[model samples]
Target: MTPTVIPIDTPGLGDRTYLAHDGAVALVVDPQRDFDRVLAAADEAGVRITHVFETHIHNDYVTGGLALAEAVGAQYLVNADDPVAFERTPVRDGDVVPVGDHMRVRVVHTPGHTHTHLSFALSADGEPVAVFTGGSLLFGSTGRPDLLGPDHTDALVHAQWHSAQRLAQELPDTTEVFPTHGFGSFCSATQSEASASTIGDEKRSNPALTQDEEAYVAELLAGLEEFPAYYAQMGPANSAGPGAPDLSDPELADPAELRRRIDAGEWVVDLRTRSAFAAGHLAGSVNFGIDGQFITYLGWILPYDATVTLLGETPEQVAQAQRDMVRIGMDPAAMATGKPEEWADGAPLGSFPVTDFAGLAQELRENPDAERVVLDVRRPAEFDSGHIAGAVNVPVHAVLAHLESIPHQQLWVHCAGGYRASVVASILAARGHDVVAIDDSYDESAGAAGLELV
Candidate 1:
């Protein structure tokens, strides 16, 4: 029987899910909270999942192993050292789990990314065939040591270095190496273009393993980017085993119902297109459209405790909106019931109109006479490559934590596109500051406008 690997891409979060085995049993690795694609794939393949495994307690995205277990009556597995509050079958080093007549998975404790990280070695006919090195060893880069904290940098790097060397020495040269995270994942310092690689290739090319432990640790720490504040809340939520979310079909409510919920202090999150949202959204609804970095912005601006009512352009849009919310550690209870049009009754949510290129040019001219605070909400590297003149660089994810440093008056915000600027606008508005989101067109014209970067 040929083993199959399913790549589950949960937009705004990352990739997960593994469907291994010839045909009878499935082993899912790190099925995150937003696993619509994984569920759909499993249903299409007609496979009965037997085991769900989480390599570790994920800090960036909520894990779906518990939910998948509940849905399919599968046993949830994790390393024996995990401090998670769930009843999981603890699999330790050298433990073999029988998959079917001719296959078995050998658990290997490869704890480097976190204190409880695990990897699995797949075997057929008593010979190792593949290895699932969740975060311990990626295709190009190893997992970031900073996840554990600055204090654990040395220990974590040493642990990862030793773990990779162990795998390189123990696993066969021909064994395939599949990692949980790939390119675009914030978890690793340098993710590979491809999702999977062979053990021999990684040993030859991975920089993390080739460098000394101290130098590797220093390089990893220095290259670390600021993660979302919401990341801290995800680890516990994933470990606790999420309760059944309200998966009921959305009921269409009248405008009065939408207005009533809004009045009752529920946050109306408009998941429409930014242009459409700018054209019109429910009075006072926060506009974070479906197209952009919806989950990242959602985590950045929305309060952890706030109840959110989603306004989507289509039925599928609403479902995606709900799924994205769960990915970022927001409880399903926070999701508001009903369709977009139905809930959009009463006065509009307070609108912070976007400024076009021409409007932005005018604002810059006018602000020069006053205390101008131009906020650049891009990543640090992006900020370094040239940014708007006289702009303070505070990444959108780090903005809330560093808000005290931002001047409270007359702040203008812009990102690579308009999406992040809108997110920044919402955050500043909540803080009672006067701010405006510059349209994407303005960012395109920044060079023409003679914006200088320091």
Candidate 2:
């Protein structure tokens, strides 16, 4: 019988955790720090978790393999050569481990995304079923190789090319490919539109399979962009073995206390809709809205050692943000729930005007002589492709450090969509800048607005 594969998606971080079972027993692959989800899946499937596997010491998020294994009393399998601090059942290339009655997993050292990366090929009753390619061969692309710093990047990319080829040549074309990255994860060398694929599909579409190694390497390296700054902390946390996240209700902060934290330079984040945040929020509380790429940007921009106090509209919203926080080994120092008014007590809330690309276009047309600053907060590549003429380019991630570069005039901020622009606008608004967030799609609205695009 073929094992059932259940993919637990963490879309905020663009990663997936797999729970595969063959009737009575289950095996988990590349689980996030929240392992309770894996336990729940196993319980629902009526199977016992007997093994946990790690693809590599992940550079994206803290792994739950060690915690999950210890919780379920399962054998935790990690690369034998990994310099990890915790005890695990060391696995190496060519090792085949039987799982219950129908499944057998063969470990293949794929070594591209990381030096000791391994992909597990699963089979049932001697027939190939699937391969879990974590941070190695992706659905239509390959995992990026530069996360190990610049020195190892060259060697890793070459290894990644060979690893993808080996999987393509060795695995049967019919075998299903379940990769942990490539679902909008920065870990992918490039993004793919495919949700699911087979080795046959990848062989035709994956660059590593179709292009010469040098060509693939050149393209992949050139395409690499900035990843989350939080990633620098992930590898060490995973190597040290992460524990299960604390999802208990955080200590509630009073209005005065919230003000104190903000004054003390602690990150008091507002997790609301960009519009809701723009309309009104506590002064000095920056927005990383729950409705958008909240975790990714928050993890990227937040200082490594900064104390974070989350403010959400409801207990559920704060709980969700807290779960996201722990994946990166961060925990909210405190929380404040309900409306911004309640959090502010009687203090006047801070706010800024929000507009669309059309509004911006009209503003430019009406006041051609006005010294208005149109800030494009998208990546440099995005700005280079096509951007508003005369707009200042400052990627949202770097805005905090490059504030001086921005003029102290009326500022209009926009990103590919409105999410990132809202983040930057909130930050600038809190710093006493007259900012307007353009809360609209850049593609659908920018060109239509008749603004000059360079």
Candidate 3:
């Protein structure tokens, strides 16, 4: 009988954890810091978790491997060469561990995402079932080689190429490919739309398998862009063995406390929808709407060690954001749940104009000399592909650092969609800059609105 594999997706983080079981016993892979989800999964599956595995010391989110293992008394497996501070059952290349009666795992040393990375190939009795390629071999891409830094990038890219080839050559073509990253993850060298794939599918579509090593490395390096700044802290936190998250309600803040924190240069983030925030919000509050990829962009642009106070329409929204934050090793300093009017305590709420690309085109046509600046907040590559003529390009992730360079005139901000544009616009508005957020789809709205794209 084949072991059943259940994917536990953290879509906001663009990662997945696996709960694979042979009916009676189970093993977990690459769990997030909030390990309660894994425990819930185990309970639903009706299996005792007997083992936990780590593919590498992650660079994106704090790992819950040690904590989860200890909670269930499961043997934790990590690479023997990881140099971690915690105790674990360290296994090496070519080592095979039996899991229950029907499943067995063969460890393959597949380095590249990190020096000590390992991929586990699972078999049911004697038949290959699946391979957990944490960050090594993805669906149509590979894990980025530069996360370890520039000094190791060159050698690591080469290693990544070979590691991908090794997996292709060793695993059966029918083996299901279960990767931890690549669904909108910055860890992927490039993104893949395919949610599931087999070794044969990757061998045909993946650059590492189709192109020469030289070509693959050059393309991969050229395409790399800035990842979240918060990534610098994840590996160390995981290495030290992260504890469970503190999901208890944060201390409630009153209107005056919110004002004080804002005046003190702390981040007062609004978690309402972008439109709701634009309609009315506390002055000096930035919008990272809960409806969008809230955690990813917030983690990217947030200044390290800055105190954060979350403002939401309800307590549940704030609670969900808190869970997302702890996965990236952050805890909110305080929280408030109410409308901006309620939080303002009779003070006037601040707001700005929200329009679509068509409205922007009309404004430009109607008042060509209005002293407005159209800002493209998409990534550099997206800007290069196509953008409004004369628009300034500043990727949303780097907007804070490039604030000095942004034109002081009235600004119209946009991204592929509107989420990032709202982020940049709200940041500028909080800083007292004249801003307008283009809440429209760039591809559909730009051309339909008769805007000139260069």
- Cα RMSD, each candidate: 3.5, 0.9, 1.3
**Per-residue lDDT for 1-454 in model 1, tens only?**
5577777765475555576755766778888765555667777887778888778888777777887788888888887777778788988888989876767888888867887788888888788888888788888788876776778767777788878888888999899988877555677767567756899888788866677777777777777776666777877787677754555545554577667766786776778776666555566566677787787777765677777777676668778777777676664333343433345544444556677555666776776577767788888978887876678888887776787888877777888878887777766664567777777644467766655546
TM-score on alpha carbons, each prediction = 0.86, 0.99, 0.97
**Candidate 1: segments with Cα more than 4 A from true spot:** 34-39, 249-266, 332-371, 379-386, 398-410, 427-434, 441-445
Q: What is the lDDT ranking, best to worst?
A: 3, 2, 1
Model 2 off-target regions past 4 Å? none
Superpose all Cα atoms of candidate 1 onto the true structure and report the RMSD in Å to 1 decimal.
3.5
Positional deviation of residue 420's Cα in model 1 after best superposition, in angstroms = 1.3
Writing each residue's lDDT as its tens digit, candidate 2 over 48-141 gives: 9999999999988988899899998999999999999999999999999999988999999999899999999999999998999999989889
lDDT of 3 at 406: 85
lDDT of each: 0.73, 0.93, 0.93
Candidate 3 minimal-lDDT segment of 10 residues: 235-244
Model 3, TM vs. native: 0.97
